[model samples]
Target: METLLQWFDLIGIVVFAFTGVLAAGHKQMDLFGAVVLACVTATGGGTTRDMILNVPVFWLAESYYLWIAAATGVISFYLIRYLQVPMRLLMIADAAGLAVFVVIGTQKVLALGHTPAIAMVMGVMTGTFGGLIRDILCGDIPLLLRREIYATAALSGAATLVILNDLDVLPGEAVVAIAVLVTLGIRLAALRWNLSAPIARMRSH
Candidate 1:
């Protein structure tokens, strides 16, 4: 079970790294910048999780994480230009990565005997921080900072996982699946509706 979870994490890392590289390409950044964004997007959330939990960083424990990010970045650099529908591809991959990371983060915090509230926050942080970093590096507003439907979707999914676990209605694999589906569904709906943060009311001059 643990091994499967680790593989899921790796998959998420790769997907996010690919999107990061795509974002970098859109910005016309050099190869170095693309790879840097990829690394940040792949490892930033996991790094934050480790620091919060005081655990050894997952990438440091396993070199495969670094290798995967690097390889994905290089591949994306060559393939990004050929992608005619980059935004759609990026959105799908980003949603997949977000869902996977949320479950992984929630499970890790739960294993540490943390409260559900803390676990949910950690789950969101783990799911979104990488994209936050990638956006910052690309000179775009971080999705989390923009009040978009992004982090909200992750939190909703993570919260659901915790709730279902407490009720014993779901176990390991089922929990992850439900979390992923919920997150992905919310994300796609938000995109379809063009949902965004509510507009702030203007003050009278």
Candidate 2:
């Protein structure tokens, strides 16, 4: 189980790093800037979660995560130019990373003896914060601040996982897997359909 979780973490790191690289590419950043952004985006969320939980940050204990992010950054920097629409690639990678991180984050909080509510919050933060930081660094409006269904998807998935765990309806791994699928499905659907939350408009007196 630990090994499986570690693999998932690595996958999330790589995909988020790819998204970061795309963001930096969109800004026409140099190689060093791209690498820095990738590393930040890949680890930012989990780092925040760990700090909030008063635990040791995961990347500090595991150097391989940084290596994975760096490698992904270098690879994406070269490959991004070949794509006609790099932003589309960024969205896809972000969705995948978000899904994986949500599950991992919820499980980590639960393992730390936190309540389900706290777990869900951490899960949402884990899934969304990296992209938030990436966007801010790239000079784009953060997706979480937009009317899109980004963080909502993470919340829904995390809530589902918490509910399933409460009911003891499935194995731990199975529950996590289903939550990830739910997140990914919702995010992808939103992207395909241009779904978004209704915007609030202030009426002039």
Candidate 3:
């Protein structure tokens, strides 16, 4: 189960990194900027997860994650010159990456003996921090802070996984699959329908 989760994490990282490179292209960044944003988006969430869990970073344990991020960044950089739908591709890939990461993150936290609440929070952080980092680096508002249903979707899936695991209703793989499906469904629906939380406002001075 642990090994499988690690593989899932690697997949999520690579996918997110690819999308990060895609998103970076929307700006007028140089090659170095693209690669930096891509790498940060790939590893930011997992690095935070490991730090909070008091474990060594997973990328340190296996070099594959590093290589994947670099390769994806490089490929995405040059490929974007010829790609006409970079934004759409980035959105889809980001959604998939978020779903996968949410499952792996929640499961890993549970394996570390944390409660469901902590697992859910960690899951959201793991799934969304990369994008948050990307947005910050790119001088945009962090998506997680918006009402785009991004973090909410990740949290819902993470919470469900923990609850199912606690009840012994599903094994690790099953939990991961269900969680990913739920996350993807909710996120895509929100995107399609433009579902968002209402912004709070203050009276004008």
Query: What local lDDT score does residue 32 receive in model 3, on the 0 to 100 scale?
Result: 84
So what's the TM-score on candidate 2? 0.96
Error of 2 at 180 (Å): 0.3
List the candidate 2 regions with Cα displacement exceeding 4 Å. 83-85
TM-score of each: 0.93, 0.96, 0.93
Which pairs clash in the backbone of model 1?
A: none
Superposition error at 96 for model 1 (Å): 1.6
The CA lDDT at 29 in model 1 is 91
The order of the candidates by TM-score, greatest first, is 2, 1, 3
lDDT of each: 0.87, 0.90, 0.85
* lDDT by residue (tens digit), candidate 2, 1-205: 6777788899999999988988888889988999999999999999999999989898988888989899999998888878765578789889999999998999889889999999999999998999999999888899888998998999988998888888997887888788889999999999999999988999999
**Per-residue CA lDDT of candidate 1, range 109-161, in tens?**
99889999999999999999999889888788887777568988999999988
lDDT of model 1, residue 145: 75
- Give the total clashing residue pairs for model 1: 0
Backbone clashes in model 3, listed as residue pairs: none
